[model samples]
Target: FHIELPMSLSDLVRLCGFRAAASPIHCRASSPPHSLPPAPVDGLDESLLADDLGAMELELRHRDAYLRSLGSPSAETVARSTLVTDSQVDQIMASEGPLDRLKDLYALNEDNEPSYELASVMLVSMATFTYLNVRYTVQERRLAGVSFEERNKLTVFASKQQASRRKMDYITMRALRLGLKRSASSLIFAPLFLGGAQCISAVRGRSSPLDFLPSGIAAGACVRGAHGLQPMLGGAFLGGFLGAVVGTVVYGIQMYCGLTYEEMRRYRLTERSERDARLMAKLSAAREQA
Candidate 1:
Protein backbone atom coordinates (compact mmCIF):
# COMPACT_ATOMS: atom_id res chain seq x y z
CA PHE A 1 0.00 0.00 0.00
CA HIS A 2 3.03 2.39 0.43
CA ILE A 3 4.77 4.40 -2.47
CA GLU A 4 6.62 2.42 -5.11
CA LEU A 5 10.47 2.42 -5.16
CA PRO A 6 12.10 5.34 -7.20
CA MET A 7 13.29 4.31 -10.63
CA SER A 8 17.09 4.75 -11.42
CA LEU A 9 18.01 7.52 -13.90
CA SER A 10 19.44 4.99 -16.43
CA ASP A 11 16.29 2.91 -16.19
CA LEU A 12 14.15 6.03 -16.54
CA VAL A 13 16.15 7.09 -19.60
CA ARG A 14 15.83 3.58 -21.01
CA LEU A 15 12.08 3.80 -20.51
CA CYS A 16 12.10 7.05 -22.49
CA GLY A 17 13.89 5.21 -25.39
CA PHE A 18 17.25 6.96 -24.79
CA ARG A 19 19.06 3.81 -23.72
CA ALA A 20 21.39 3.72 -26.78
CA ALA A 21 22.37 7.41 -26.34
CA ALA A 22 22.91 7.13 -22.61
CA SER A 23 24.95 3.97 -23.11
CA PRO A 24 27.79 5.96 -24.75
CA ILE A 25 28.49 8.21 -21.77
CA HIS A 26 28.47 5.19 -19.52
CA CYS A 27 30.75 3.31 -21.89
CA ARG A 28 33.09 6.32 -22.32
CA ALA A 29 33.49 6.71 -18.59
CA SER A 30 34.43 3.09 -18.23
CA SER A 31 36.03 2.29 -21.67
CA PRO A 32 39.76 2.38 -22.46
CA PRO A 33 41.33 5.43 -24.30
CA HIS A 34 42.00 3.24 -27.39
CA SER A 35 38.28 3.30 -28.28
CA LEU A 36 36.70 6.32 -30.13
CA PRO A 37 33.48 5.92 -32.06
CA PRO A 38 35.02 2.98 -33.99
CA ALA A 39 37.39 5.41 -35.76
CA PRO A 40 34.54 6.60 -38.07
CA VAL A 41 34.68 3.25 -39.93
CA ASP A 42 35.44 4.86 -43.40
CA GLY A 43 38.04 7.27 -41.92
CA LEU A 44 36.66 10.11 -44.16
CA ASP A 45 33.80 12.64 -44.17
CA GLU A 46 32.36 12.57 -47.72
CA SER A 47 30.05 15.61 -47.43
CA LEU A 48 32.57 17.76 -45.55
CA LEU A 49 35.38 16.78 -47.95
CA ALA A 50 33.20 17.70 -50.95
CA ASP A 51 32.45 21.09 -49.39
CA ASP A 52 36.20 21.82 -48.88
CA LEU A 53 36.99 20.81 -52.50
CA GLY A 54 34.20 23.06 -53.85
CA ALA A 55 35.54 26.02 -51.84
CA MET A 56 39.04 25.38 -53.17
CA GLU A 57 37.79 25.21 -56.78
CA LEU A 58 35.83 28.45 -56.31
CA GLU A 59 38.93 30.20 -54.88
CA LEU A 60 41.01 28.96 -57.84
CA ARG A 61 38.43 30.25 -60.32
CA HIS A 62 38.45 33.70 -58.65
CA ARG A 63 42.23 33.83 -58.80
CA ASP A 64 42.23 32.95 -62.54
CA ALA A 65 39.60 35.60 -63.33
CA TYR A 66 41.58 38.24 -61.48
CA LEU A 67 44.71 37.35 -63.46
CA ARG A 68 42.83 37.41 -66.78
CA SER A 69 41.52 40.95 -66.11
CA LEU A 70 45.12 42.18 -66.22
CA GLY A 71 45.50 42.52 -70.00
CA SER A 72 48.43 41.64 -72.28
CA PRO A 73 51.69 43.58 -72.39
CA SER A 74 51.93 46.85 -74.41
CA ALA A 75 54.53 47.85 -77.02
CA GLU A 76 56.53 49.82 -74.44
CA THR A 77 56.42 46.92 -72.02
CA VAL A 78 57.62 44.56 -74.76
CA ALA A 79 60.39 46.98 -75.62
CA ARG A 80 61.51 47.20 -72.01
CA SER A 81 61.50 43.42 -71.67
CA THR A 82 63.54 43.12 -74.88
CA LEU A 83 65.61 46.23 -74.32
CA VAL A 84 68.49 47.20 -76.62
CA THR A 85 71.43 48.25 -74.48
CA ASP A 86 73.48 51.43 -75.13
CA SER A 87 76.46 49.35 -76.16
CA GLN A 88 74.38 47.55 -78.78
CA VAL A 89 73.08 50.85 -80.16
CA ASP A 90 76.62 52.23 -80.29
CA GLN A 91 77.78 49.10 -82.10
CA ILE A 92 75.03 49.53 -84.70
CA MET A 93 75.83 53.21 -85.24
CA ALA A 94 79.54 52.48 -85.55
CA SER A 95 78.97 49.71 -88.08
CA GLU A 96 79.05 52.28 -90.90
CA GLY A 97 82.41 53.61 -92.21
CA PRO A 98 83.28 57.34 -91.96
CA LEU A 99 82.74 57.94 -95.69
CA ASP A 100 79.39 56.14 -95.55
CA ARG A 101 78.42 58.23 -92.56
CA LEU A 102 79.38 61.44 -94.34
CA LYS A 103 77.35 60.38 -97.38
CA ASP A 104 74.40 59.59 -95.15
CA LEU A 105 74.63 63.05 -93.62
CA TYR A 106 74.77 64.83 -97.00
CA ALA A 107 72.38 62.56 -98.88
CA LEU A 108 69.67 64.50 -100.80
CA ASN A 109 66.79 62.37 -99.64
CA GLU A 110 63.38 63.32 -98.25
CA ASP A 111 64.87 64.07 -94.82
CA ASN A 112 67.36 66.55 -96.26
CA GLU A 113 64.88 68.50 -98.41
CA PRO A 114 65.30 71.98 -96.96
CA SER A 115 63.84 73.51 -100.10
CA TYR A 116 60.64 71.55 -99.66
CA GLU A 117 60.40 72.67 -96.05
CA LEU A 118 60.98 76.28 -97.06
CA ALA A 119 58.29 76.05 -99.71
CA SER A 120 55.84 74.46 -97.30
CA VAL A 121 56.51 77.14 -94.68
CA MET A 122 56.05 79.86 -97.26
CA LEU A 123 52.84 78.27 -98.48
CA VAL A 124 51.47 77.97 -94.96
CA SER A 125 52.30 81.58 -94.14
CA MET A 126 50.69 82.73 -97.37
CA ALA A 127 47.60 80.67 -96.66
CA THR A 128 47.30 82.06 -93.13
CA PHE A 129 47.48 85.68 -94.32
CA THR A 130 45.09 84.91 -97.15
CA TYR A 131 42.57 83.38 -94.75
CA LEU A 132 42.75 86.45 -92.51
CA ASN A 133 42.33 88.79 -95.49
CA VAL A 134 39.39 86.82 -96.88
CA ARG A 135 37.70 86.69 -93.50
CA TYR A 136 37.91 90.46 -92.99
CA THR A 137 36.75 91.07 -96.54
CA VAL A 138 33.76 88.84 -95.98
CA GLN A 139 33.00 90.56 -92.70
CA GLU A 140 33.25 93.98 -94.34
CA ARG A 141 30.92 92.95 -97.14
CA ARG A 142 28.42 91.62 -94.62
CA LEU A 143 28.60 94.88 -92.65
CA ALA A 144 27.97 96.80 -95.85
CA GLY A 145 24.55 95.14 -96.11
CA VAL A 146 25.53 92.71 -98.87
CA SER A 147 22.88 90.05 -99.31
CA PHE A 148 23.85 86.45 -98.56
CA GLU A 149 23.38 85.35 -102.19
CA GLU A 150 25.51 88.17 -103.60
CA ARG A 151 28.18 87.71 -100.96
CA ASN A 152 28.39 84.03 -101.67
CA LYS A 153 28.74 84.74 -105.39
CA LEU A 154 31.63 87.17 -104.77
CA THR A 155 33.39 85.07 -102.11
CA VAL A 156 35.41 82.97 -104.56
CA PHE A 157 36.73 85.96 -106.49
CA ALA A 158 37.59 87.93 -103.34
CA SER A 159 39.42 84.96 -101.84
CA LYS A 160 41.46 84.43 -105.01
CA GLN A 161 42.47 88.10 -105.25
CA GLN A 162 43.39 88.29 -101.57
CA ALA A 163 45.44 85.09 -101.89
CA SER A 164 47.39 86.48 -104.86
CA ARG A 165 48.29 89.67 -103.01
CA ARG A 166 49.24 87.75 -99.85
CA LYS A 167 51.56 85.46 -101.86
CA MET A 168 53.58 88.47 -103.08
CA ASP A 169 53.61 90.05 -99.63
CA TYR A 170 54.88 86.78 -98.14
CA ILE A 171 57.80 86.66 -100.56
CA THR A 172 58.77 90.28 -99.94
CA MET A 173 58.53 89.91 -96.17
CA ARG A 174 60.64 86.71 -96.25
CA ALA A 175 63.32 88.40 -98.32
CA LEU A 176 63.58 91.43 -96.05
CA ARG A 177 63.63 89.31 -92.92
CA LEU A 178 66.28 86.91 -94.27
CA GLY A 179 68.43 89.72 -95.59
CA LEU A 180 68.40 91.60 -92.29
CA LYS A 181 69.08 88.48 -90.24
CA ARG A 182 72.01 87.33 -92.38
CA SER A 183 73.58 90.81 -92.65
CA ALA A 184 73.30 91.54 -88.95
CA SER A 185 74.76 88.14 -88.04
CA SER A 186 77.64 88.60 -90.42
CA LEU A 187 78.39 92.13 -89.16
CA ILE A 188 78.31 91.12 -85.50
CA PHE A 189 79.28 87.49 -84.76
CA ALA A 190 81.46 86.75 -87.75
CA PRO A 191 84.12 89.24 -86.69
CA LEU A 192 84.22 87.90 -83.16
CA PHE A 193 84.69 84.28 -84.15
CA LEU A 194 87.12 85.04 -86.96
CA GLY A 195 89.13 87.48 -84.83
CA GLY A 196 89.43 84.96 -82.05
CA ALA A 197 90.70 82.38 -84.50
CA GLN A 198 93.23 84.89 -85.81
CA CYS A 199 94.44 85.69 -82.34
CA ILE A 200 94.85 81.99 -81.67
CA SER A 201 96.91 81.62 -84.84
CA ALA A 202 99.06 84.64 -83.94
CA VAL A 203 99.73 83.19 -80.50
CA ARG A 204 100.84 79.99 -82.14
CA GLY A 205 103.51 82.06 -83.99
CA ARG A 206 101.88 81.38 -87.34
CA SER A 207 100.90 84.23 -89.63
CA SER A 208 97.14 84.21 -90.08
CA PRO A 209 96.30 82.93 -93.51
CA LEU A 210 94.07 85.15 -95.63
CA ASP A 211 91.03 82.96 -95.80
CA PHE A 212 88.11 84.13 -97.93
CA LEU A 213 85.64 84.41 -95.07
CA PRO A 214 83.18 87.21 -95.76
CA SER A 215 83.98 88.94 -92.46
CA GLY A 216 87.63 87.93 -92.31
CA ILE A 217 89.05 91.45 -92.98
CA ALA A 218 86.88 93.06 -90.35
CA ALA A 219 87.77 90.25 -88.00
CA GLY A 220 91.43 90.71 -88.92
CA ALA A 221 91.20 94.43 -88.13
CA CYS A 222 89.85 93.66 -84.68
CA VAL A 223 92.50 91.00 -84.19
CA ARG A 224 95.30 93.32 -85.33
CA GLY A 225 94.68 95.65 -82.37
CA ALA A 226 96.23 98.42 -84.50
CA HIS A 227 95.69 102.20 -84.12
CA GLY A 228 95.92 103.51 -87.68
CA LEU A 229 94.56 103.28 -91.21
CA GLN A 230 95.35 99.56 -91.30
CA PRO A 231 92.51 98.68 -88.87
CA MET A 232 90.04 100.76 -90.83
CA LEU A 233 91.15 99.23 -94.06
CA GLY A 234 90.87 95.71 -92.65
CA GLY A 235 87.41 96.42 -91.18
CA ALA A 236 86.11 97.93 -94.44
CA PHE A 237 87.42 95.03 -96.43
CA LEU A 238 85.88 92.51 -94.03
CA GLY A 239 82.50 94.34 -94.02
CA GLY A 240 82.36 94.33 -97.80
CA PHE A 241 83.26 90.66 -98.08
CA LEU A 242 80.72 89.63 -95.42
CA GLY A 243 78.07 91.86 -97.03
CA ALA A 244 78.67 90.27 -100.40
CA VAL A 245 78.50 86.70 -99.05
CA VAL A 246 75.33 87.47 -97.11
CA GLY A 247 73.85 89.20 -100.16
CA THR A 248 74.74 86.24 -102.34
CA VAL A 249 73.15 83.72 -100.02
CA VAL A 250 70.03 85.81 -99.53
CA TYR A 251 69.78 86.46 -103.28
CA GLY A 252 70.14 82.77 -104.08
CA ILE A 253 67.41 81.78 -101.63
CA GLN A 254 65.12 84.56 -102.81
CA MET A 255 65.68 83.68 -106.45
CA TYR A 256 64.82 80.05 -105.82
CA CYS A 257 61.65 81.02 -103.96
CA GLY A 258 60.73 83.61 -106.57
CA LEU A 259 61.18 81.13 -109.39
CA THR A 260 59.03 78.61 -107.58
CA TYR A 261 56.34 81.21 -106.94
CA GLU A 262 56.44 82.36 -110.58
CA GLU A 263 56.19 78.79 -111.82
CA MET A 264 53.12 78.20 -109.65
CA ARG A 265 51.64 81.52 -110.75
CA ARG A 266 52.16 80.73 -114.43
CA TYR A 267 50.60 77.32 -114.00
CA ARG A 268 47.57 78.89 -112.32
CA LEU A 269 47.33 81.50 -115.06
CA THR A 270 47.49 78.79 -117.68
CA GLU A 271 44.70 76.91 -115.98
CA ARG A 272 42.57 80.06 -115.83
CA SER A 273 43.19 80.77 -119.48
CA GLU A 274 42.18 77.25 -120.42
CA ARG A 275 39.01 77.57 -118.36
CA ASP A 276 38.16 80.89 -119.97
CA ALA A 277 38.81 79.49 -123.39
CA ARG A 278 36.47 76.58 -122.76
CA LEU A 279 33.79 78.93 -121.47
CA MET A 280 34.18 81.23 -124.44
CA ALA A 281 34.02 78.32 -126.89
CA LYS A 282 30.87 77.01 -125.21
CA LEU A 283 29.24 80.49 -125.31
CA SER A 284 30.15 80.96 -129.00
CA ALA A 285 28.73 77.54 -129.87
CA ALA A 286 25.50 78.31 -127.96
CA ARG A 287 25.19 81.70 -129.70
CA GLU A 288 25.68 80.13 -133.14
CA GLN A 289 23.04 77.46 -132.42
CA ALA A 290 20.63 80.16 -131.29
Candidate 2:
Protein backbone atom coordinates (compact mmCIF):
# COMPACT_ATOMS: atom_id res chain seq x y z
CA PHE A 1 0.00 0.00 0.00
CA HIS A 2 2.86 2.38 -0.91
CA ILE A 3 2.21 5.18 -3.33
CA GLU A 4 5.20 7.50 -3.06
CA LEU A 5 4.61 11.12 -4.04
CA PRO A 6 7.21 13.89 -3.74
CA MET A 7 5.95 17.05 -1.84
CA SER A 8 7.40 20.59 -2.00
CA LEU A 9 8.37 22.61 1.14
CA SER A 10 5.66 25.15 0.27
CA ASP A 11 2.93 22.45 0.32
CA LEU A 12 4.23 21.14 3.69
CA VAL A 13 4.17 24.71 5.17
CA ARG A 14 0.63 25.26 3.86
CA LEU A 15 -0.51 21.95 5.42
CA CYS A 16 0.90 22.99 8.78
CA GLY A 17 -0.87 26.36 8.53
CA PHE A 18 -4.17 24.66 7.75
CA ARG A 19 -3.85 22.33 10.76
CA ALA A 20 -2.95 25.30 13.09
CA ALA A 21 -5.94 27.30 11.82
CA ALA A 22 -8.32 24.35 12.13
CA SER A 23 -7.62 23.64 15.81
CA PRO A 24 -7.32 26.52 18.30
CA ILE A 25 -4.47 26.46 20.89
CA HIS A 26 -5.64 24.48 24.02
CA CYS A 27 -2.51 24.96 26.23
CA ARG A 28 -2.59 26.72 29.65
CA ALA A 29 -0.39 29.58 28.33
CA SER A 30 -2.91 30.21 25.51
CA SER A 31 -5.34 31.72 28.03
CA PRO A 32 -4.39 33.68 31.19
CA PRO A 33 -2.44 31.76 33.88
CA HIS A 34 -5.38 30.90 36.24
CA SER A 35 -3.13 31.01 39.30
CA LEU A 36 -4.87 28.70 41.84
CA PRO A 37 -7.86 30.90 42.80
CA PRO A 38 -7.36 32.43 46.25
CA ALA A 39 -8.79 30.06 48.94
CA PRO A 40 -10.12 31.12 52.34
CA VAL A 41 -7.70 30.41 55.17
CA ASP A 42 -9.45 28.11 57.62
CA GLY A 43 -6.67 28.07 60.20
CA LEU A 44 -6.68 30.97 62.69
CA ASP A 45 -3.38 32.27 64.08
CA GLU A 46 -2.70 30.95 67.63
CA SER A 47 -1.71 34.40 68.90
CA LEU A 48 -4.92 35.99 67.58
CA LEU A 49 -7.08 33.25 69.10
CA ALA A 50 -5.28 33.62 72.42
CA ASP A 51 -5.80 37.40 72.34
CA ASP A 52 -9.55 36.97 71.67
CA LEU A 53 -9.87 34.53 74.56
CA GLY A 54 -7.99 36.92 76.86
CA ALA A 55 -10.29 39.79 75.86
CA MET A 56 -13.37 37.65 76.61
CA GLU A 57 -11.97 36.70 80.02
CA LEU A 58 -11.27 40.37 80.85
CA GLU A 59 -14.81 41.37 79.86
CA LEU A 60 -16.26 38.60 82.03
CA ARG A 61 -14.13 39.75 84.98
CA HIS A 62 -15.33 43.33 84.55
CA ARG A 63 -18.93 42.18 84.40
CA ASP A 64 -18.40 40.07 87.54
CA ALA A 65 -16.89 43.06 89.40
CA TYR A 66 -19.77 45.32 88.40
CA LEU A 67 -22.38 42.78 89.45
CA ARG A 68 -20.57 42.19 92.78
CA SER A 69 -20.58 45.95 93.48
CA LEU A 70 -24.39 45.84 93.15
CA GLY A 71 -24.64 43.12 95.85
CA SER A 72 -25.30 40.52 93.19
CA PRO A 73 -23.01 38.15 91.37
CA SER A 74 -23.33 36.99 87.79
CA ALA A 75 -24.42 33.37 87.34
CA GLU A 76 -20.90 32.33 86.34
CA THR A 77 -19.41 34.05 89.38
CA VAL A 78 -21.92 32.32 91.63
CA ALA A 79 -21.13 28.96 90.07
CA ARG A 80 -17.40 29.55 90.53
CA SER A 81 -17.91 30.73 94.09
CA THR A 82 -19.77 27.55 94.99
CA LEU A 83 -16.67 25.58 94.00
CA VAL A 84 -18.91 22.82 92.59
CA THR A 85 -17.41 21.19 89.54
CA ASP A 86 -19.04 18.89 87.01
CA SER A 87 -17.71 15.82 88.81
CA GLN A 88 -19.15 17.02 92.12
CA VAL A 89 -22.52 17.66 90.48
CA ASP A 90 -22.47 14.16 89.03
CA GLN A 91 -21.53 12.67 92.39
CA ILE A 92 -24.30 14.57 94.15
CA MET A 93 -26.86 13.40 91.64
CA ALA A 94 -25.60 9.82 91.89
CA SER A 95 -25.54 9.81 95.71
CA GLU A 96 -27.44 6.95 97.36
CA GLY A 97 -29.42 8.74 100.07
CA PRO A 98 -32.37 10.98 99.13
CA LEU A 99 -31.67 13.28 102.10
CA ASP A 100 -28.07 13.68 101.00
CA ARG A 101 -29.20 15.26 97.73
CA LEU A 102 -32.01 17.24 99.36
CA LYS A 103 -29.60 19.87 100.62
CA ASP A 104 -28.13 20.45 97.18
CA LEU A 105 -31.58 20.39 95.59
CA TYR A 106 -32.82 22.96 98.07
CA ALA A 107 -29.85 25.18 97.29
CA LEU A 108 -30.55 24.91 93.55
CA ASN A 109 -31.87 28.01 91.79
CA GLU A 110 -35.62 27.36 91.40
CA ASP A 111 -36.98 30.53 89.89
CA ASN A 112 -39.69 28.76 87.97
CA GLU A 113 -43.47 29.02 87.80
CA PRO A 114 -45.56 26.58 89.86
CA SER A 115 -46.44 23.35 88.12
CA TYR A 116 -50.15 22.55 88.03
CA GLU A 117 -49.40 18.91 87.35
CA LEU A 118 -47.43 18.53 90.55
CA ALA A 119 -50.13 20.32 92.53
CA SER A 120 -52.79 18.06 91.05
CA VAL A 121 -50.75 14.98 91.91
CA MET A 122 -50.27 16.18 95.46
CA LEU A 123 -53.99 16.90 95.80
CA VAL A 124 -54.84 13.45 94.51
CA SER A 125 -52.41 11.81 96.92
CA MET A 126 -53.86 13.69 99.90
CA ALA A 127 -57.36 12.80 98.81
CA THR A 128 -56.44 9.12 98.53
CA PHE A 129 -54.88 9.13 101.98
CA THR A 130 -57.90 10.87 103.48
CA TYR A 131 -60.26 8.41 101.82
CA LEU A 132 -58.27 5.41 103.06
CA ASN A 133 -58.10 6.71 106.62
CA VAL A 134 -61.84 7.38 106.74
CA ARG A 135 -62.62 3.98 105.22
CA TYR A 136 -60.35 2.32 107.76
CA THR A 137 -62.09 4.15 110.62
CA VAL A 138 -65.52 3.07 109.35
CA GLN A 139 -64.34 -0.55 108.99
CA GLU A 140 -63.05 -0.58 112.56
CA ARG A 141 -66.64 0.16 113.75
CA ARG A 142 -67.66 -3.46 112.81
CA LEU A 143 -70.81 -2.31 111.08
CA ALA A 144 -70.41 -4.75 108.17
CA GLY A 145 -72.05 -7.87 109.86
CA VAL A 146 -74.74 -5.79 111.63
CA SER A 147 -78.45 -5.80 110.67
CA PHE A 148 -79.80 -3.10 108.31
CA GLU A 149 -81.20 -1.07 111.21
CA GLU A 150 -77.95 -1.39 113.15
CA ARG A 151 -75.98 -0.49 110.06
CA ASN A 152 -78.26 2.47 109.59
CA LYS A 153 -77.44 3.52 113.17
CA LEU A 154 -73.77 3.37 112.23
CA THR A 155 -72.11 5.28 109.36
CA VAL A 156 -72.87 2.98 106.41
CA PHE A 157 -70.29 2.07 103.75
CA ALA A 158 -72.36 3.90 101.11
CA SER A 159 -72.35 7.06 103.24
CA LYS A 160 -68.65 6.60 103.84
CA GLN A 161 -68.05 6.27 100.10
CA GLN A 162 -70.11 9.38 99.45
CA ALA A 163 -68.20 11.33 102.08
CA SER A 164 -64.88 10.19 100.69
CA ARG A 165 -65.98 11.18 97.18
CA ARG A 166 -67.05 14.58 98.45
CA LYS A 167 -63.76 15.03 100.27
CA MET A 168 -61.78 14.11 97.16
CA ASP A 169 -63.88 16.46 95.08
CA TYR A 170 -63.33 19.25 97.58
CA ILE A 171 -59.59 18.66 97.61
CA THR A 172 -59.38 18.71 93.81
CA MET A 173 -61.53 21.82 93.58
CA ARG A 174 -59.47 23.63 96.20
CA ALA A 175 -56.23 22.73 94.45
CA LEU A 176 -57.51 24.06 91.13
CA ARG A 177 -58.85 27.21 92.78
CA LEU A 178 -55.57 27.81 94.58
CA GLY A 179 -53.59 27.27 91.39
CA LEU A 180 -55.74 29.83 89.60
CA LYS A 181 -55.34 32.24 92.48
CA ARG A 182 -51.59 31.85 92.48
CA SER A 183 -51.37 32.42 88.74
CA ALA A 184 -53.52 35.53 89.05
CA SER A 185 -51.39 36.83 91.91
CA SER A 186 -48.22 36.25 89.90
CA LEU A 187 -49.66 38.18 86.96
CA ILE A 188 -50.57 41.09 89.21
CA PHE A 189 -47.51 41.18 91.47
CA ALA A 190 -44.82 40.42 88.88
CA PRO A 191 -45.10 43.83 87.24
CA LEU A 192 -45.37 45.57 90.59
CA PHE A 193 -42.24 43.81 91.80
CA LEU A 194 -40.33 44.72 88.65
CA GLY A 195 -41.47 48.33 88.82
CA GLY A 196 -40.56 48.55 92.50
CA ALA A 197 -37.12 47.10 91.81
CA GLN A 198 -36.55 49.61 89.03
CA CYS A 199 -37.66 52.46 91.27
CA ILE A 200 -35.42 51.31 94.11
CA SER A 201 -32.49 50.95 91.78
CA ALA A 202 -33.13 54.43 90.45
CA VAL A 203 -33.42 55.84 93.96
CA ARG A 204 -30.22 54.12 95.00
CA GLY A 205 -28.29 55.66 92.08
CA ARG A 206 -29.47 59.16 92.99
CA SER A 207 -28.31 61.38 95.89
CA SER A 208 -31.70 62.79 96.93
CA PRO A 209 -34.42 60.50 98.26
CA LEU A 210 -36.90 62.63 96.36
CA ASP A 211 -35.48 61.29 93.09
CA PHE A 212 -38.38 58.80 93.32
CA LEU A 213 -40.87 61.65 93.50
CA PRO A 214 -42.55 60.82 90.22
CA SER A 215 -43.02 57.14 91.11
CA GLY A 216 -44.10 58.09 94.63
CA ILE A 217 -46.70 60.52 93.29
CA ALA A 218 -48.03 57.93 90.83
CA ALA A 219 -48.14 55.19 93.49
CA GLY A 220 -49.73 57.47 96.11
CA ALA A 221 -52.36 58.55 93.65
CA CYS A 222 -53.06 54.92 92.78
CA VAL A 223 -53.30 53.84 96.45
CA ARG A 224 -55.47 56.80 97.41
CA GLY A 225 -57.73 56.53 94.40
CA ALA A 226 -58.15 52.79 94.74
CA HIS A 227 -59.34 50.95 97.86
CA GLY A 228 -57.09 52.41 100.58
CA LEU A 229 -54.22 50.84 102.52
CA GLN A 230 -56.18 48.08 104.29
CA PRO A 231 -57.65 46.35 101.25
CA MET A 232 -54.36 46.73 99.34
CA LEU A 233 -52.36 45.19 102.18
CA GLY A 234 -54.84 42.37 102.58
CA GLY A 235 -54.71 41.58 98.86
CA ALA A 236 -50.92 41.77 98.90
CA PHE A 237 -50.80 39.37 101.84
CA LEU A 238 -53.19 36.91 100.22
CA GLY A 239 -51.32 37.03 96.91
CA GLY A 240 -47.95 36.56 98.61
CA PHE A 241 -49.28 33.59 100.58
CA LEU A 242 -50.73 31.94 97.48
CA GLY A 243 -47.55 32.54 95.49
CA ALA A 244 -45.46 31.06 98.29
CA VAL A 245 -47.66 27.97 98.46
CA VAL A 246 -47.35 27.48 94.70
CA GLY A 247 -43.57 27.91 94.86
CA THR A 248 -43.32 25.43 97.72
CA VAL A 249 -45.33 22.86 95.78
CA VAL A 250 -43.03 23.19 92.75
CA TYR A 251 -39.93 23.02 94.95
CA GLY A 252 -41.19 19.86 96.67
CA ILE A 253 -41.81 18.14 93.35
CA GLN A 254 -38.37 19.09 92.06
CA MET A 255 -36.79 17.76 95.20
CA TYR A 256 -38.77 14.55 94.87
CA CYS A 257 -37.69 14.14 91.25
CA GLY A 258 -34.01 14.84 92.06
CA LEU A 259 -33.88 17.73 89.58
CA THR A 260 -31.48 19.88 91.56
CA TYR A 261 -29.86 23.03 90.17
CA GLU A 262 -26.55 21.21 89.99
CA GLU A 263 -28.17 18.36 88.11
CA MET A 264 -29.76 20.83 85.69
CA ARG A 265 -26.42 22.57 85.26
CA ARG A 266 -24.70 19.28 84.57
CA TYR A 267 -27.33 18.21 82.05
CA ARG A 268 -26.95 21.49 80.19
CA LEU A 269 -23.18 21.15 80.12
CA THR A 270 -23.39 17.58 78.87
CA GLU A 271 -25.76 18.60 76.09
CA ARG A 272 -23.48 21.46 75.06
CA SER A 273 -20.45 19.22 75.13
CA GLU A 274 -22.15 16.60 72.99
CA ARG A 275 -23.26 19.23 70.48
CA ASP A 276 -19.75 20.72 70.33
CA ALA A 277 -18.25 17.28 69.78
CA ARG A 278 -20.61 16.57 66.91
CA LEU A 279 -19.86 19.97 65.39
CA MET A 280 -16.14 19.34 65.70
CA ALA A 281 -16.55 15.92 64.06
CA LYS A 282 -18.47 17.45 61.13
CA LEU A 283 -15.83 20.15 60.75
CA SER A 284 -13.03 17.58 60.78
CA ALA A 285 -14.77 15.43 58.16
CA ALA A 286 -15.35 18.48 55.96
CA ARG A 287 -11.71 19.53 56.35
CA GLU A 288 -10.57 16.02 55.41
CA GLN A 289 -12.80 16.01 52.30
CA ALA A 290 -11.41 19.43 51.35
Clashes of each: 2, 0
lDDT of 2 by residue, 120-142 (tens): 33454455445554554445334
Q: Candidate 1, residues 1-290: lDDT per residue as tens digits?
A: 78775897667644544432346655456555353332123467889999999999888677556544654333234334444445544454445344543343223444555433234434544554455555554444344333333445534645767755754554455445444443443334443433333333223322222222434455545534355787667666765576457545643564666632223323333444445555665565456546
Clashes of 2: 0
| RMSD of candidates 1 onward, in order | 28.3, 24.2
lDDT of 1 at 19: 37
lDDT of 1: 0.46
Highest-scoring model, TM-score: 2
Candidate 2 runs further than 4 Å off: 1-85, 88-226
